[model samples]
Target chain A: MLFDFAKSPIVSERQYDVCILGAGAAGIALALRLGRAGKRVALCEGGGLDYEDESQEIYAGHTFGDPYFDLDIARLRYFGGSTNHWGGYCRSFEPVDFNRGYLGDDFRWPITHDDILPYLPEACDIVEISSDYQDRLVDEELGLRQVDFKYSPPVRFGEKFQDEIERSKNIELFLNCNFTDLIGADRRVRSVKFRNYADQELELRASAVVFAMGGIDNSRQLLWMERRHGARFFDRDLPIGRYWMEHPHFTIGEALIKSWDQANLYFALTEKMQKSLGILGCGVVVEEQGDSTTKRLIKDLLCVAPGIGAWAADLAGKKLICSYRFHAAWEQAPNRENRVALSDRAVDRFGVPQSELHWRKARIDRETMLASTQQFNAFMLRENLGRLQLRDWVYQGDEYPDDDVLAGYHHMGGTRMSSTPRYGVVDGNCKVFGAENLYVAGSSLYTTAGYNNPTLAIVQFALRLADHLGKVV
Target chain B: MNRRFFSIAGFLALSLGHVPLFRRYFPQRIKNGWLLKDEDV
Candidate 1:
């Protein structure tokens, strides 16, 4: 049952087995799982089925430390969440990503890849992605192996799952509802207060609650709650709204291949080589070189691969003039300082404190880019597969380029998961450490971001959380 | 013996043809200073 809280009469005090906040991929995925499991679910969405400028304004906030997209436009505020504009590139985290020692400094997950691997098949189905992530594709002509990604139809949760949710007997979707405050008593969330766009206030109780409000909102809402309701509201000491990370997408280099056959090698790398090189996966898209760009590529290539450079220069009208862009969505080193905090001065239309993000790339981020670029260079040189004219900033000092580039809009890691309370906000089970029935879903629980996009892994982790909650709740 | 010698010769010829020898000596240098344009070179 869908209720437009603005027009619908407020149900003063409702109770359910599970109450989910935020109707994004994580929230909707959990609703489907819990509903199918025959548990009554009250799924709350802050906005209606469509985008609204007034509602979207709630996301407007200030950025403090690093340059970033305006918080207002970075994430869509309506139903389906950011998936409304998702590009749907899907791949799983590397097995190495789960190993604590790989990243060090307790920047590791209490859970392993095996924990989430079981739910991937169902997750893939939900996101409309077919075929497994191909980690290795051989380009024998260039003697290189590359990783491949599968594209989703890019499922908008609102359109794709709305009808099913409306039809579900056990799931009640409350739209146009704003989660105003969480009322907790003695470590358990007693009830949550909410409002409609019409200024109608309501409250609900649940056996268990999950905050699936994305990286930004999950942390922002919790940060506000902790301040008003006391630090014990979420975690007493452990950080919240901190360690916010994004995949910094920037052009690392431009390359030119000898022919179309040689061009494919630059597109992806083999899983074997990636592991051996200790680098994250990335893709290279070949763009046709313009007249001036072609001249530049030739001159650049001549210094590296003189034979191929000469071939490209002399080649007839076969359109061999090409330059490639290395699109790397590498992981950001999870630093405590790259965070989001409640803005002291500003409040949204709902009169709630707005968020301010303090995000900056660290030394590890710079090293990863430099090392990964060098690894690709080595492979190209070893394989005799064309050459790359490195990006100016890559060779320049350690400072990263923040002017022309933008963050991946993949907000991750604020309420991170760990085994204990000292390091993380949520437990291995994605439950808030201090609160018994409170849990967090979505990329917010990601201990570290992988080069792969978050939508697939977001669904995978949500399903895993649902499976865990379904047993006890 | 003739077949073995011919196979080795073919391998060498292919390697020399596809993978140029000069690349080892004067591989594209990612220069430290500003990027060199065609006119600059």
Candidate 2:
């Protein structure tokens, strides 16, 4: 049943098999899966049915390094979460992402890719995308592989599953319910407390509690909880908000190439090449331009190399040449310093400290994009297909331009999964290190962020977490 | 016929014909589109 916490009658205490905070992709997926299995679920959403400026204000905070979107605007604060404004791009993480031991312990995931492979079909069904992913190896030597991505009609969880959740016999969705704190002791959560806009409070007791809050808030709330309650809730030593990551997006350069069938194709280096080059994953998108752009590129080329420019002009006349804008969205290696911490001075209306994100691109991040671009350049030169004219900043190794698409707004890591508490916050099953009944679900639990969009993998992990919570609860 | 003049003119014409090849050997250095040298690649 649906109940707006602001309007619904006050219930001092309620009980459920599982209490899931946040009704975004992860929370909704987990709640639906558990409800289908006849488990009582309390799916709590911080925001109401639609967007509200007051509700969004809670996400406001400071960004210390790099040019980033304001915390409040980076993600939506309504029922469907950020899915309300997602681009619908979907691709699963490659096996190399999970088993990257060569990159170091920080890059390794406790679980293998095979562990999540079984759930791909169901995850694809949940997101309304095809399960088949066709990847073609374009050049074996250069390790250039043309990857396939499935686009969703971009399912908004709130719009699509509202009726089902409302009609669910075992699920109770509470909108406009903001999580305040957990009331428990001895590393076992007994109840969760939430307050509505009117400051009316409600407490929910559940055998299991899952924090499916979006990537940043998961760490922000946990950090606040740790500061408020100390080691009473969970291990205090676990990195609460460290190792945060993002996929940096930049228009690397322009390219002139012979007309090919693959026009808006995604390409990434193979695992072997990544290991050889000592770089992370990078996805390059080649967007073919029209005749006007081709002519413009020929004109630019004519100013530099007249011979190649004349040849390119001739090719353009014959309709054999194509101009492209090469863009790249690459993975940022997890750095302990790049983290989300609580702001010392600022607090929300509820008096909770706001999130202060410390994020910057490392040298390896630049190398990852540069290496991928160089590989593409080599492929073009080797095949006699085209030439790549890199941007001045890229070739010169200057600071990343602020005007470009700075990032994909794909927040990942922070409350990452690892085998031990020293390396990460959650275990392989996404259970908090010392907390028995508390678990985390979302991209925040990602051990390492790959170049693909996090929504598909977020649903997969939610489904997986639901399966785990099913047998226990 | 002036044989010496003819030889010089013929030589000049041949050199002119191979100007494109000389241009190929010493290509213009453009600021953008910086191609990686063989060793760098």
Candidate 3:
């Protein structure tokens, strides 16, 4: 049943089998699975049914280092969480993503891809996408493979699961109930506290508490909790707000290929090539440009070299040459400095410190995109397909252009999973280390962020977490 | 206004005046492999 926190019956304390702290994609998926298993759940959301200025203000914070989207505008705080505005690009993490021990201990995920494979079909169903993914090797020598990405109807969790949650006897969703903190002693959370917009407070006692909060919030809330109550809750040494990562998106260059038919094509380097080059994962998207763009490119070329440009223009006029824009969204290696910390001076309406994100693209990030582009360019040349012209910023080693897409709003890695507390905040089961009943869900649990969009993998991990909670709770 | 003569002149200008431009922007023959260095021309 759904209830507004401020208007609900006066229950100062309630008890449940499991209490999920954020009703986003991950939270909702886990709640539904546990609900089907007849587990009573308290699914709490910070915002109401829609976007509200008051709730969004809570996300307001400061960003340091490279330019990034405003903290408040980057994510939605409503019942659906950020899924309300997500583009629904779905792709699973490759096996290599889990086996990156060579990069460093912190880069390795505690679990393998096969651990999440069983939940793919069910997770794909929740987001309304097919499970089948087709990948073809376009160039064996260069290890360049054409990859596939499934588009979701872009399911908004609030609208899609509202009726089901309302009808389920095992699930009770509370809106406008922002999680304040976990109240516990010595690794066992006794109760979870929340505050409504009206300053009304509610607390719930559950056997298991899962923080399915969005990526930034999971780390922010944990950092705040540690400040208030020290190592009593979990391991103090855990890297709770470190190793944050994002997929750097930019228009790397323009290309003129021959006889291209697809509107968009995705390409990535194989694991072997990535190892050989000592780089991370990268996905290059080739999107065909219109006739006007082709004409403009030819006109620009005409001024630079009249003879070849005239020949190119003639071919374009005969519909022989195809113009394309090359956009690449690649992985950023996890850096300890690129992280999320609570602002000491700025606090939200709830008097909680706002997130202070420290993020900057590293040298390997540039090499990942540049190296991937070179591979693509080489493919075009060797196959007699055509040529590519890199953007001046990329070729000349200038700073990233501010006008282009700086990064995909895919927040990942704080509270990342690892085999031990030295490298991560969460264990292989997504449980907070040193805490028996506290767990985290969402992209925040990712040890390594691959080039693919994170929503598919987020849902998979949520379902896996639910299965684990079923046994314990 | 002979089209053939203008085309020849354009070709000569491109071949002589734009060698560096071609070497910089255009596709070159991949002799060793496709994985060019970070400073790939």
DockQ of each: 0.02, 0.08, 0.02
Output candidate 2 Cα RMSD.
11.2
lDDT of 2 at A216: 96
Place model 2 in a CAPRI quality band. incorrect
Local accuracy by lDDT, each model: 0.76, 0.88, 0.87
Model 3 alpha-carbon drift over 4 Å, by segment: A303-311, B1-41
Better of 1 and 2 by DockQ: 2
RMSD per prediction, one decimal? 10.9, 11.2, 10.0
Candidates sorted by TM-score, descending order?
2, 3, 1
* 1 against 3, candidate with superior lDDT: 3
Q: For candidate 1, lDDT tens digit of each residue in A78-169?
A: 88989999888887786767763444655778988899888888989998877476545455433244666678888888899999999999
Runs of candidate 1 exceeding 4 Å displacement: A137-145, A231-233, A262-292, A299-308, A315-321, B1-28, B32-41
**Which 10 consecutive positions of candidate 2 chain A have the poorest summed lDDT?**
A6-15
Instruction: Score residue A435 of candidate 1 by CA lDDT.
Output: 83
**TM-score of every model?**
0.86, 0.93, 0.91
Judged by DockQ cut-offs, is candidate 1 incorrect, acceptable, medium or high? incorrect
Query: Alpha carbon lDDT of residue A289, candidate 2?
Result: 81
Question: Model 2: which residue pairs collide?
Answer: none
TM-score (C-alpha) between model 1 and the true structure: 0.86
Compared to the true structure, candidate 2 yields what TM-score?
A: 0.93
